[model samples]
Structure formats: C-alpha cells, structure tokens
Target: MQTISKNITTLLLLSVVFSFGGCKKFLSVTPSTQSVNPVTIKDFQEILNSDSLSRTQFFPLDLMTDDVALTDNQFNTGDNFYRRIYTWDALIWNPAQIDFMYNYSYAKILQMNVILSRIDAAKKDALNTPQTKNLIVSQALTNRAWYYLQLVNTYGAAYDVSTSKTDPGVPLVLTPDAYALPARASVEQVYGSIISDLKKAAANTDMPSKGIDIIHPGKAAVYGLLARTYLYKGDYESASLFADSALTQESRLLDLTQNPYMPNQLQDLNTNPEVLLGRISSDEGFFKTYSNTFVIGGSLLDSLGGFSTADKRFSNRFSTSRFSPGVYKQNQLNAQTMVFDNSVAVPEIMLIKAECLARKGDFSAAGDLLDKLRSSRIINYSPSGRTYTADNILSYVIGERRRELCFHGGLRLFDLKRFNKGTPFRQSILRTSYSGTNYAELLPGSVLYLLPLSAYVLAANPNILQNPR
Candidate 1:
C-alpha cells in the first residue's frame, strides 16, 4: 500500500505530466498506461466514470463502533491492526503503513481538481455541449464534497456551531497543484465548502433529474448528498427539505418483506431501487474476511430483535458464521453476499426526514414516516400496533437507524461523535478484549473520538497538525 509519501510523489509527478489508465490496484501511484492530459469533455467524463472514483478509499470504520465484538481466538491471535482499531487505539497506524482513508480520499480529490481546473477550456463537441460540461462539473463537485465530508468527520472534531470555526479539519486542497503543503482548514470551512458544492451541483439543471445510474450523481443524488450533509451539520430544517426533495425525485425503498430469508437479493445496484448512489469499500470483501473473528455486538443484535414474521432485516442480512459456528455475524455485506452501498440512498434519506420531523416536535408525522418505511422492511407491520409514544419516538427513530444503517459507510462512528454533542444520545461505549484482561472505553467528550493522523501522513506533510489525543 502506498503511503502519503507516495501520494505526494505521485502528485509531483502528475503535475509535470498528466497520465491515466495505470495502476489497477488501490493507491498505485504510477499508471501502467499513460494517456495525455484531458483536453476534451469525453476525457473528463472518462476520469469521472472510473469505478475507483466511487470506491471508499479507507478501511471500513465499522470495526471501531459499538456494533461489533471480537471473538475469543481471533481477538487473541488475529490481526493486530484490526484489534488496535477495534479497541480504539490512539495511533492505529505503524510508521511505514499508509493511512488509506486519508491518502486515498485526497487522491480522489486530486482527480476532481484536475477536472474542475480545466473543464471549461476543454474542447466541446456536438454531443458534449455546455450542458454536458455542467453535468460533468456537477458530478465532480459532488464527489469532492462527499470526500471532504468523510475526511473532516474522520479527522476533525464533530461539527458544533460554537466551536466549528476553530476546530481543525482536513487539508482543503482545491487545485491540481501538489507542491504546496496546505494547513488544515476549520471544520466550519470544510462544511461550508461541502454545502456550497452540493448546492452548486443541484443548481445545474442540465444534469439528469435522477441519477443515470447508482454510480453517477444526478439531481436526486445531489439533493440526497445535501440532505445528509446538512444532517451532519445539525441543520434539521434544511435536512428535512432536501431529503423531501430527494425522495420526491426518487424514493424507491426495497421491500424486504418479499425476500425475508434470501442471502443475496439486493446485490445489483442497477436493480436496487432504493440506492441513489452506490459505493463500497475498495476492498469490498473486508467484512466477509473479518466475519470469522467478529460477531454482531449483543446490544445491536438486541435492537434488531429476535426472528419474527414482523421484521425481516435480521433474518435476511445476518446469520451464524460458518467459520465460527454458533457465533453470529452480518452475512450480507461484501461481494460474497450482498454488496453494501454506503453512499446516498432512499432508505437513509427517509430516515433522515423522519429524524428531522421527530426532532422538530412533529412526532406524529415522524411516526407515520417511520411506520411507512418499516412496513416495507417488516411484513404485517401496523402503525397503530406500534407503541411509539411521543416521548420515545426520537429514540425509536435512532434505534431503527442503527439497525438499518450499521456497517454501512462509517455512519455509526459519525453518529456517535455527533450524538455526543447533545444529551439524549450521549453515551460511553465500553468493551474488553477477548481475554477480558484489557478494557477500552470511549466517553462522550473524549478526545479519542477524533482519530489521530497517521504517522506517515504527518511525516509527509510537515505543516499538518495532528488531532489531540
């Protein structure tokens, strides 16, 4: 794996001579085949169309959340790298290893910058007109916004209006130039850039009304991204509005009731109506490989509830591990079963809208929306039968969010960080090693919530400041 040092080297090289279509492996600096710099709209589109652009550039963060537990033998003898992450280690990376999340996110950001820097000057053919340019720009902007959002949430403090202005975020690298080492922008600035990009992307009406495919961003995808971004920023009203906008354009939730016990029913993004924009970890089988050693946490399992005709998410998505008999693990993530889609999707947007409604004292409306979503996932679900009191409605929504969204993207970690900023959802996560000899706890206000920059990253960029540990 190439570290930030190699990324910097790659960038310096690309600055001198632009190339493409080399290095099939993740983080390969040199392309095996080199093409000239993009001088046409088609070239820009080709760069954006690469599947690697949509792939999550980091190790999955689900290991760090409370939703996973370590098995006895594996925790004791398995990979130390994952164990370090599972225990929320202050420094998870060795000196020489690459920080995949940090480096690859910036790598994709560099690609976006390349397109944004010269799209206007590129030759426009009969088919690739100004509207085509707008569409390409929209996709690039949305991609950059999403990457920055992920980087800031992982490296910087959780967004707080009071402290965001000063809270250090990841470096705001905008141009294709890679020689200058930029300092971390504030969390507020990072968020501001994300929102600006999404809004700009959304305003480009020449783009398709809905995403052309799950891989590309369209108007609905832009709205969904904006909704989630605002939700992370703690702007409920905007979140609700944008989510509504997105759902209106494309709100096709999968009926989990139809295939309750099927192992891989929702694997195809083209057929999956709910996925607005699909993305997976670069190593898509990470979960499946890890399942031999990790099991679903007791609390998360309890929230999912026992086998029932009412709810099918647990039955369809999880099962006892064949590698470790009698232990339960999520069976439907990764390439073997159902590929997990971590990007903007219909169900998540619905959940966002429901949460916003509940937070705004519209419990009835929120309950209705939640029940509507539950009905699709749960057979014979009755809204009247659900005992959702106004007092516990928000908790119910959050609990459902946990059950539905766990192990997808790094959302659980993101939720924990943001929820800790308030009272109702603030929690102290406690876990012990398989040997029960060592324990790790993450308190609501702990500095450990903010991950430290890898030693490699710090070494590569002298101006970058590490997060407080």
Candidate 2:
C-alpha cells in the first residue's frame, strides 16, 4: 500500500511538471538539437490520461453521509480524520491532516489548465491537425469542468440559486500560474464557468467516439456531465434533454443477474459497458478500513424491503462481515481497496431522466424509465404490479436513485444536499455504532452539509473565505 501511494504521488508530480514546465521549460533549457516538451498531440493526451490525476478521493464523502456506519471497536480506534468527518465535526479541516479530496482535485485542475494553455502552441507546431487539436482542447475543457465541479461541491456549498451569489465557491483557477492566489469565486460564477466549459466540449463534433481510456472524457461523457450538473442545479428540462443526448450516444447497462459473481472485482475501466467514464481510488488502506469498519445503516437496509431479495445488488454489493453479526458491509467492487465508479453510468442517467420527467408531470414516461431500470435489477420484476402516478412518481424515482447509487461514488452526500432544499423531500441522516450506544446525526439543511475548506488553504490564501459552520 505504501508503495502504491508513492507511485500515485510520483504520477501526480509528473503531471504537475508536464503541466507547468512542459513546452516552455524545454524550449529554454534544451539544446537546439533536442526535441521540445509535448512535441506531439499524444504528449498532451498522456498528461490528461494520468490514472492518479483522474482517480478522485471521495472516501471521506462516504463517511460523512448516512449510507455507512462504524462498528463499535472500529469507531473507538478509527483515525482522527475519519472520526471527525463521521461526526460532522466543524474542525475537520486541521492543516496537519492529509485532505486527499482537496489536494487531488486541485492537482487535476492544474493539469487541465496547463493542457488548455499549451494546446494552441501544439496546434501551431503542426503536431496535430485542426480537428485533432479541437478534440484535444475539448477534452481538456471537459476535464477542467469536472474537476471544478468536484472542488466546488466538496469545499463549497450546494447549488442553491437563492444564495449562490453570496455562497463561497472553490477558487476558479483557469491558468497554470501556480503562484497566483485567487479569492474564492461565488458559487454562481463557478457553476457558470463549469457550464460554459461543458458547452464548449459538447460543441466539438470531432471528439473521438469514445475515450481511448475511460479516464479520458468523451462526447457522451460531456453530455452526461452536463445532465448531472443541471440536475444538481434543479433544472429538470435541461437535465432531461442532456441525459437523452448522452443515452443516444451510448446506453449500455450491465446486467447484474447475468454476471452475478466475480472474485476481487475492481470495476476496472472499460470493462463494464455501463461505464461511460471511470475512476478508482489509489488509497488501499482507506478502502480496507472502510470495508472492515463500516456497515449499512439499519434504516437503509429496511428500505430495500422485498427488493433486497429480488435485486442482485443487495447480495452482490454487501455481505455480513465476521467483525459483527447481522451487520452488512458494502463490498460492491469485491476488493480490499476502494475502486469507485465515478463515471456517468447507464442506471444513473436513466434515473436522472426519470426524475426530470416526473418533475415535468410526465408520470407515464417517468414510470416507464424507472420500470426499465428496475426490471434490469429485480430478478422477477413485473410491470403490471408497478404503477406510478404524478404525486408518487418523484418519491419512487428518488427512492430508486438512493438504492441504485449508494456507495458507488459519493452520490449519497450529494443527493442529501440536492434533495434537502425543502421540507417535503428533506432528510435527516442518523448513524449508530454496532452496540447502538454511540451515534451521529446530520439534519437536513444543516450548514455541516457544506464541508469547510482545508485549513491549509485558508492559511495560504487569506483572501479565500470558509463555508459557514
């Protein structure tokens, strides 16, 4: 594990070097006979394709949400960082602690910015044709938008149109100037910039049909991201349209029942047809701890109801660990290390479209979409028994979303925030230890839902403001 961590760090450092010093430094330091840095299109693509840079850290996100809980012994002996996050402590941003989520996000953003800044030079050098250059630029823009979306959602507040203008978002760093210390942008500005980047990426028709690797964002991935962003912002019409666009490009659902069992399954990139894009954590120890310490919340298990038997997800994704009896721990990937599927998958897109249709009062259309996904997961699903009306359609869709998306890629926390805007859909999350003696609660609309920026960030950039406690 230590070796793996070192390798990941080395890759990130390499990415940083290429991003900051690639072409310019080579031109200055190399002999006239030597070739310049990033002399070809592949050089730029290689930087964007770094596995370490693309695999985001959202393990802390899983701990902060209600989907997971600690065993009695695990809770007592857990690291301070995990404990603090699990309890929703206001002081979780200690500078001494390693905030992988913050650091990795910014690192990838820097890499994307560097690529975007140097792409023009690559074009002028004739290393890439006009079409290839446009495609490369589009990929960079998509990556930049994705990284910013992760940063703002993690370090800043959820998108609330009423308060977005006043809310502190992550700093919008669009250039490769590492020394520049910019103040945090408003949430509105950050989201607008993300939308703009995605629009540009989507407009590029020459983008490769699919990424050479799942880490490289493709045209469908672009549309999928746009759909996700609009969905988070509560724009149902745009979400539906973009989701439709993405599905048209690529729609492949992994039939869980068909391939029900596999040993040490890590959900590798390009292996799953459902995955339009994919990322997995490099922190092996974090995943081992998560699997050993955490179990599904009791309430969540009950919500599974009959579906727990009919749906292969229940048996496939979880198991009763020897650490505790009757306690179920998540093992979706069937690996000791955490390998999350962060890409836009078919099931997620379907749910997004269903929810949007429900919002627009298209009960029949929404119900059909929901039924299609449900039928895929449920062993003996019968549509005749499943009927949804407008009043109950949204509720059903949201419930299915919870079941389908939990523990995959930190969707639980984001869903909690996005749906907790009002009284009707607001949720209060409760987590209890194995003995049922120790517990934590995160109420709906609580300021704690918005994680604070790392103390290291605030110390370095005095102009940056912290999220409210």
Best of the candidates, lDDT: 1
Model 1, poorest ten-residue lDDT window?
25-34
Every candidate's lDDT = 0.75, 0.72
lDDT of 2: 0.72
- Total clashes in model 1, counting residue pairs 3 or more apart in sequence or in different chains: 2
Cα distance off (Å), candidate 1, residue 316: 2.7
Best by TM-score: 1
List model 2 lDDT by residue over 359-422, tens digit each. Answer: 8889999999888887777787888986799899998898898888876556778888887878
Candidates in order, TM-scores: namely 0.88, 0.87
Q: 1-469, model 1: which lDDT tens digit per residue?
A: 4568766675565644333223232221222232345667777766766666666734447777888787665666655567777777876787888777887788778878878998888875875687888998999999999899889998888899999999999899888765769899999999999999999999997888665566678888889989998999899999999999999989877798895433222225556777777676533334454545356776787787653335676656556445543243333443443234576788899899999998878888888888888988877877776776678889989998998887676888899999999758999887865556547888897888887888898998999999887
Error of 2 at 345 (Å): 1.4
